[model samples]
Target chain A: MFFLSPFELKGDIDSVFERDPAARSILEVLLCYPGLHALILHRFAHRLYLARIPLIPRLISHGTRFITGIEIHPGAKIGKKFFIDHGMGSVIGETTEIGDNVTMYQGVTLGGTGKHSGKRHPTLGDNVVVGANATILGPVHIGAGSRIGAGSVVVRDVPHDSTIVGVPGRVVRHKGEKTYDVSLEHGKLFDPIESLNAKLEQKMAHLENRVAELEKEKRRSA
Target chain B: MFFLSPFELKGDIDSVFERDPAARSILEVLLCYPGLHALILHRFAHRLYLARIPLIPRLISHGTRFITGIEIHPGAKIGKKFFIDHGMGSVIGETTEIGDNVTMYQGVTLGGTGKHSGKRHPTLGDNVVVGANATILGPVHIGAGSRIGAGSVVVRDVPHDSTIVGVPGRVVRHKGEKTYDVSLEHGKLFDPIESLNAKLEQKMAHLENRVAELEKEKRRSA
Candidate 1:
């Protein structure tokens, strides 16, 4: 059994209401939210892990995973007011560290790439929002207030207050600007691939026109 | 209680061994493998759904979701020999259809757009392989032998024998050719964003060189 402070528990509950529009009541959040369930379980498991209690901590972690579908390693360190919305298939690695007021959507992975030992997972700063199915691999740092777009694969460090979108994520906005609301509207995010293809089409048209003019000039001279 | 044919049961069990290299033995697969569990449960639920049993089928679906972390609506039609590896966070919407020998990875969503009535989900053809975290929305048809890459969001129809990649997926390989093996190696898939960025750099360089030459020629003539 794990003993949790009422203040900390209230803070976690408050976070769900602050971030999620779908949260109807405190009773509903308490009974239905798997994210909150997993967090509470992890806190207990983490304490056992810190106490050097071996198999029990791992067993509790495994049972929590079976129930919640969210895998949080007992060795990971998570701060206050952490909220994971629809947290299915979300994985937090052993060496990972997450800061306060962090929000993550479903299928997000804070994972490692190689088999190297120490500090092999990501460290997320305060107020970081990671969208659905976003994978952040290796020992990278995601700065405070950064928003990672949905379905993005990030393998490198991201700066503070940046908006990261696309595969092998490129920093699209870094002006410390905030947009829209806290709720993640994945469809509204900028389509970088579409934008690039458009630019490519424009350039190709210009080159074709220039080549045609050059051909006509040569013909006239001849 | 739901009765399943022994032949269909064997086929489903065999699929785990065929598709996933991690399957050690029959006992391991039967005890583990949430995909197999979810599929078996879905078959039972689907039978009840066709019989027009009201809340029980939906209740079974909900219970299955709780255990497996894979949500398959009772109204969805699935095919034979289908395999879902690491089935967490996968959702199959109502009116979604699948063909024989189709394989799906973790976090895949066969979903719909808008609140339209009939056939709002995707229909996948035989031999289609959808990778991890890939989302196929709307009532689009995925042609036979097509491979969808990891983390790709596809909203439009894809042609046969095509390899789709990137966000809002583009057909990267449409030659009716196959590559590597069946098991999805997400890291090895063609990165269209990187390729486009390289092409853009080359085009910009060529344009800059041509502009410099034209300026020098004009200066000489003057």
Candidate 2:
């Protein structure tokens, strides 16, 4: 009996189901879900972290990561109002602290510099949006209100009143855009997809070419 | 009720619980799992492929690949009695009709070749063992009673009662001291993952290095 009921998890579970057009029913996610197991473990770990169990709490987190590839370091203090989207290959490193109201996409790595110790991994101030395949490395502090672009490999500190993009991300747009408090309105993260659609498109195009070639060959045979 | 119980659906439900050294309780896996959802979706697609849903099945299979790096083509008729190791970034292509009694490692890609389109994927014969990160491409066939080496990129059709290894896999050994009925012993298919343990170890090693360097630097500073 953790603080939240397992039934309450249905809301987020429903979100996943809503996206997956293939899912037949809800009972499927409830009975045999490792995701559910992970949630329960995180809750226990979070409680242990709050109770100041110290190293053991972090150990639990690492064990979870080993099985799941979704790492949430115990030292990285996350607020209660937190949820992950399409949680695969997502790494949250130790010493990286996140504030209230943050949503991250898939393949988002909250990692450290190659050789830096003590407070490496970004100190994400409140209301931060990290795009997919984004790597935020080093001990750099990101301002409270910032949006990191997809596939960005950030190394330095990001200013609060700006939007960052590209490798070694730089501010792309921030002149007149409203500094919308991410906490006030942190909408759902993007659809948890990497390049599935693109690959399908590629295959479809390949098929089209093949069909055309086949037709040409048929004409030759004719 | 759904078609199959979550406990029975091996692909998506956290079936890891069945393994030794697994989690103590079911609650721990749900919240933090990164690959559970993908695995679940994979089970459905894999089954659909068995039912022969044609292109839609493959499309949905690609969708699973996009969401999770693990790809199991719907057209590749795989047998039961198999397991995926790490199950990340693994690709099993179309036209690869696998026999019973086979196993594969992680980062393994069973793909097709130039636009010939006649049973594009490899037909893996029975009682075969493919190592981690091995790539078996083209419509070429792999004979029954064979073992493919890890990190090998295979292109040619393998001989029966043989062992292939290396970049363009060369026969390492033939007549590997074993005698079993290839017809009766079924093949198995799943994602390769045992090879990925090195990555986890590397992460731990990198962390150790940082701590060791910090201690040395602290001594110098003092």
Candidate 3:
């Protein structure tokens, strides 16, 4: 039976208070939070996996997934003070490497692109916050202090202190602020599609105005 | 004490066979499929909810969600043979209404806009297939035989026999193919962003050629 170090337990609890404003008490965090439960269970399963215990580790992982709705593969290496808030439908693949002080919201997938074998999942650096329903696929590196916006599908590497958003996510902000606070304002992020559509509309209006001017010139000549 | 009707059970089982070609035996489906487990549990919880049993229905729904990773609010009304393949992260909101023969994949959210109180969730018509991670938000109506593509976020009503895709979903195909089959070819779907980029590139090429022709004519005049 694998047990959590007292330091790890304290760090996990402290991280919850630091991240979630709604976390009222330690008892509530311990009992009510599925994310916390999942992480604790993962620690146990990971220990079993490291010990070369075959089927039992996977079974434990499966049971944890069923209970928590957060599927973290037993083989995934997670660092200290890792927090997942409202972590339903979050899938961490076997090869995923998560660094210290990493926070992930619900429906975040650290997955493979199904192209290559071995080390296919994402490697997240320290203090990375991934937003809701954001998919970081393939063996991409998410550098430290980066924030990935909600509903973004990131398939490429993100540099340090960057903000990523949109499908095939682009870095909207890079290396601006050192102090990283998790931003839930995903709606405020730049939408490339909407921007393109607005540009097209402007072009159409310009063309129409030019056509009207040409018509007026033709009539004046006549 | 709410139990499924015999017809409902048979229909649910039949749908598994129809949709999943790999489904060989009834026993395997009954025991192994988490999707089926969720649906069966929802039937019970939904009945309790309709009966106005306070707290019990919600508790039942919570338990089912915990086990299946598919959260269906007890207040939601789902029709017969509603199949959810790889049902993890699939959320059905409280006021959502789904018609018969609706199939949904994993990570699909039939959710609300959170701006309204009553009837705030989507209403999906018969023979509607929602693909993986597709979010149909608000009190929108999805017409019969319509297909929502993978990762599409649809906020408005969809017409019958239409195929919707993209971030703020646009109908790419409409009024064609009466027979609706669940299309997993999400990669083949028309990407609006890519199309816009291609158009821009073509315009630039055309302008470059026109500029070269103008320069040639000017040189001749000189």
Top-TM-score structure, candidate number:
3
Candidate 2 lDDT at B203 equals 51
> Clashes in each model (backbone N, CA, C under 3 Å)?
0, 29, 0
Segments of candidate 3 deviating more than 4 angstroms: A1-33, A39-66, A71-86, A91-105, A109-131, A136-150, A154-164, A171-190, A197-222, B112-120, B138-140, B155-157, B167-169, B182-187, B205-213
* Docking quality tier of model 2: incorrect
Where does candidate 2 stray beyond 4 Å?
A: A1-40, A114-117, A160-162, A175-222, B1-222
Candidate 1 per-residue C-alpha lDDT over B1-222 given as tens digits, one digit per residue, 9 for 90 to 100? 466789898999998887654345686677667789999999999999999999998999999888888899999999998998666889999899999888887789999999878889999998898876889999999998888876788999999878887777888877656653532433335667778789887977788579657656655754
List model 3 lDDT by residue over A1-222, tens digit each. Answer: 588988899998888887764455676577656788899999999998999989998998899887888899999999999999767889999999999999887799999878666899999999898866789999999998888876689999999888886777888878756654434223235556777777876885675566556556655754
Two-way lDDT contest, 2 vs 3, winner:
3
DockQ of every model listed? 0.15, 0.03, 0.13
What is the number of residue pairs that collide in model 3?
0
If you score just chain A, what TM-score does every candidate get? 0.87, 0.61, 0.85
Residue A113, model 3, lDDT: 77
lDDT, candidate 2, equals 0.58
Name the better of 1 and 3 by TM-score. Answer: 3
